[model samples]
Target: MKITTNMHEGRRTEMYACGAWNDMIITDYLEMAVTKTPQKTALVGYRVHAGDRSAMSYSELDRRITRMAAGLAALGVEKGDVVSCQLPNWWQMSALFLACVRIGAVCNPLMPIFREHEMQYMLAHAQSKVVVVPKIFRHFDHQAMLQGLRSELPDLKHVLVIDSDDEQSFEQVLLQRAWEEEVDTARLFAERRPSADEVVQLLYTSGTTGKPKGVMHTSNTLLSNIRPFSERQGLSATDIILMPSPLAHQLGFLYGLMLPVYLGATAILQDVWEPAFAARVVAEEGCTLTLGSTPFLADLVDIARDEREQQASLKTFISAGAPIPGALVEKAASVMQGTKVISAWGMTENGAVTTTRPEDPQTTAVHSDGVALPYMQVKIVDGEGHEQPAGEEGDLLVRGASQCVGYFRQPDMYQLDNEGWFATGDIARKDATGYIRITGRSKDVVIRGGENLPIADIENTLYKHPAIQAVALVGAPDERLGERLCAYVTLHDSSATLTLKDVTDYLVEQKFTRQYLPEYLEVLAALPRTPSGKIQKFKLRDMARDIFQGQASHA
Candidate 1:
């Protein structure tokens, strides 16, 4: 692995340590804000739907956080406790996250889309004692889901519903309670804050394999990951960040929530991805920094192209989650004024591993995921784990302060074998200029426009259909979507009639979003299998490609 320029300058090491990367935690940075600029607007949560806006000054934000910390303590949320939160991009989420850290609790932020099954798995695995969720959001029955999960999860004790139009409101808890009662406990506990190495967050990856693994991250790891990128991008108090990506994801949390607050900048939150609304946010709020997935960027570009007033304030548009096609990059550059489409590559295991530098040559941004951030090291290795020469496609490995501590409770899988590097599971090539380009994932996961759709989950869901005897979910290439789900179904009886619509409709009823639903379905008398009786998904994938191509031509 080659080290990039000035990557580890301010990194800390033990008295005898030699590495460039420092070990620090989230509190280290929060204290900086309190000490330097306590009067600045640390966070601002605007509810565009309700025409309501709220601002939190740095000092006030810190105060509210302390109060929330006290409140959590009253609920019996102790240190090392897993606090699950499924809220939108609101001020409460930010305040609660900081409060959790203040009390030495691991923050488990989950997507609001997660239903009973997903919530059950995450809550059970994390052993989350407290869950904070919105009462109802956009017609989704969140309260019902919480009710269903309470019985299944014995460890779960406290259920705090945010934005509830009821007596048990988040405000009532803070306003009605005697702050003096818990203030000393919170302050005393805050004094004994966890070290940088202690896990601050247990972020679960949207697994494309078995169950999702909880990626544990410490404060030092997160700060090290963000410092270089923040400094490099010149994130400051003047900048206003517009993030459409769900805060549950790393990019959204780091950039949308943490980065802006860390830099004394304002973070504009949008509950849903509405392009017209996104453009309005940029134009109206004077948003200078925006981060999202490829599809989100595409939608923004389309909306901006349609609305002439859009993109007047956007300066940097960070694209991650999946590859940003060169054509879309060019299109965005042409459509938006003073905006650059920057591609980034990373995972839940490590935040923002690689990114295209803003000042890099146009060719660099177009061809690479940019150079490694300061303090990070990258390498390409063969199947035998030997280093590959420059420009050769191999498994991408990275080691940095930002790298995750390890999978929660899965210690055996955490350590890097002799090499002191974590396998990124991405196949990439490092050029002479230190630019890395992602080619594919080493795992059998499908990147459908940035969201990793696990094949096994879809297959398992499909198997529930009574008419379907066996199923294999595979990815077929698509220009627009990057990849579309294709399901190969073997019927229980040869005479049984099962159409593609039948499977799709059933999946819809099962609450599998439209994106996960298979675009093409093949009813096979018998699925092709290997000697081990394992259905060859690769063969089915090829068949899907041929079927899609034939259908395209016929149309």
Candidate 2:
């Protein structure tokens, strides 16, 4: 077994003493649900591609976790080893995560869309002992891809296949029924459960830098994130949670799997992201709360607009991972009544840091990212690391128990400064009452002749335009001015294509400063985005270098 457990023992003790880190681990709560309400519905998962619906009771889930754990032990998985999986929102993922905790392995869930390049870097970083991949997901033969790279992944001892015609099927090997009959699962698990302070999860950042960084979090740190949202929202066993986001991401994992189990609530998982299908599941399953990125919220609202009957049960909609346009927030009240369209901001390093309260003033959601959650703190700092006062745009920093422990296998690279705060690389401002408004990325902003162009403000302005469907503002390379703002826009079907003049005219009407106005406009079929739906601005920057250069070069 690898020694990846509890690297920062002093930090854990301090957090626990300060009431930031609760002593309870995740499995303890799962077991509580098992013991208290064994027959209660724990999960309802839909695999749209396979045309199947799977459900599990608390008792059944408990047994499956046990069996899977025993099976993993038999396959030579041990404490502190990495159990990497790339799956959709499936019941097997839920079981596999619990299975990992049962034997004290770290869970490293890769995005299903990740091809060989990302997989190579991450698998090598984690030194993953086992990797679970879909046999064929979204028409890509994942098994074949991994099989081709097996020689390169020296630490990979086993490959568990999911949903395929293979001898080493995940269901056949790990999740086989009645493993306790052959082995002492309870005893095996009892001997292996990791402490709450030990690193048990690895979530990779979809970085602009070529390689992704694996952000490590212990049980205490993760729970510090979940508990705040749960308490603030008053989540309980009665609430039904719906997840349209990828479970591999922290947003889905926290609310989809961990939160429901922690609260002993029923969680509904939708594997495929069809807005219409998502609406049906919400109605049919009586889902109350959903948390996802801005696009998911938009899709849900679009479906709710058309399919009125499917939205009656939804109480809360938490939008994160991207900026929430003020227009989207204002549209929500009338479009989807009786639901809180809460805006939030967070990262893989810091789980759900700031979030607008469900009962927060309507304008707050439209104007600000959110207020800091309990035990999670956020502050703005100047360039020299001095804390900036409210209403001044500066670098955002966070220090709290919920923050990630460090980067996976690269502790030295996780640069927490002398004050124990992690630099968030976001330019933001806090209101007098402590609401943070994300202005732009520290690295993503464009400067034209020593003046910073308001990229996010321009994007938000363009989003409100009737003709534009989606918009991205990138810093185009300019030799003299250093950089210039270039707007890439996608037009709505109902509208005519917008020219550079049309875009500038709209921004002018919106009262945008001439300095921040887009110098060039490029129409794109779609904005290049990560699989999780974040706009890949770096790609846009590269594309910007080739456009409208002669005008800037000669002038």
Candidate 3:
């Protein structure tokens, strides 16, 4: 599926002319590093519990990527084919993406947290030809799940499992042999070098109000953000990146995996978020930079305060997906003496569009998201489409080189205006100096840590319960995670009872992701509704906030 259009061509020309896009695919960068820094450490993966660590140099990693590409080709994967991978932050996950680039195929990375509920929709919608998963991750049998799903998805022809030595294991099939030598190297490069405009990533974002839409991005669009964003942050080949965020999310994919490759830098991957483990790794590796959500910073601060030596080598921490509280920023600065905590805001549609600068006051991130990167534009507009004055909260909209091409197989769902602006569904205010402060979301979303919960999907599932007559999901205040999901329900019969555990049990039985289950449940006689009978979620949100505040005060 080619995603290019006249509009895309026009954008590409504009971006290239202005140097927002350098017109180089990620594989080109990998090859450049292979020739220039062949012996440099390109990747370091840590599997803490399994007591395993792997490191690969640039040249060795490139060779492995080529072999992996040949393995995919041997499985009948070709140009434009979608290859989905549901793996953890292991070395193989990073290699798989680069291999997709080598073979000119679209790569779709699914979060390991996703179960049959989300996988069924995403795999079938993307029409993936190949899916790679772990034999078992976190005690869940991923191989079994995919095997069960295979019969339902006719497009899924191959299921390759990682962390296993079986016939279908990724290492056995893709790594044990030198398949690159068997393939016609000259013809493979000549026939399969993908253009920068071709869609390289298909990321399905958890929706706030509807089914997940597959966000499609090309090399030019993704690299557009990486180049300027990294430059502004003063990242270089000398710096080491310690990434604990999930590789499946854009935070880890763009920065943890792609950014290091782009800069010829080293990336240290941590598959799980253990603050003590992360702190130790950063010090041991001398990692200089990292990016994650507010919760990560909070946990790191807690650890650094107790073990100051663990975070001594850290230089930068960029927080996104939620507002950074001023108190937390102060605490982090106090504990990690030289580390700069930068604030940023963006979506899956576009990578980090705005971020606080290193030279700015430490408090700037507390008050505002930051100024837009050079290649992007941000504006706040009223309901009538007029630009709002500074300090006035309005709809947040953004557009630029980093904006995704369109939604996969759902062009009409993109809904960018004629001028190329995309509505962000966020309400925010812009200062006279252009920094934006996110006030609230026009869309109902519960941002637990850095992940957006699928509110509509969860609510719809709850509606199927025999006891529920009405249900509304809202985000409740939480200092560490920014927000925790709260569910308010009205029972079918006045005497019908419901408890938080009961609600969680039902959702789990329905295959809902455990991490997204509501932390609090409220049983009400009737949900607050407007005169016209529409549910007033704002009222429920306020109630949740009041209850949370009360609990905090009592404690």
Task: Tell me the number of clashing residue pairs for each predicted model.
Answer: 8, 0, 0
- Sequence-dependent TM-score of model 1: 0.91
Preferred candidate (lDDT higher): 1 or 2: 2
Which structure is stronger by lDDT: 1 or 3? 3
List where candidate 3 sits over 4 angstroms from the true fold: 1-7
User: Can you give the TM-score per candidate against the true fold?
Assistant: 0.91, 0.81, 0.98
Tell me which residue pairs clash in candidate 3. none
lDDT of each: 0.77, 0.81, 0.90
Worst 10 residues of 1 by lDDT: 1-10
| Residue lDDT tens for model 3, 1-555 | 555432456777788899887769998889888999999999999987786789999999988888999878888998989999998889888899999988899999999999888999999999999999999888899998888788889999888998777777878888888888899855786588788888899999997778999998889899999999989999899999998998899988999989999999999999888888889899889999999999999999999888987888899999998999899999988999889999999999998989999999999989989999988999999999999999999999999999998888887788888888999999999999999999999997889998999999999989999999999999988889999889999997998788999999998898877987999999998899999999999999999999999999999
Q: lDDT tens digits, residues 336-385, model 1?
A: 75787788888888789789987875455667887788777899999998
Give the per-residue lDDT digits (tens) of candidate 2, residues 413-475. 688776678888889999998999988776656655433354655676689998899998888
Name the top TM-score candidate.
Answer: 3
Sorted on lDDT, highest at the top, how do the candidates line up?
3, 2, 1
Best prediction by lDDT: 3
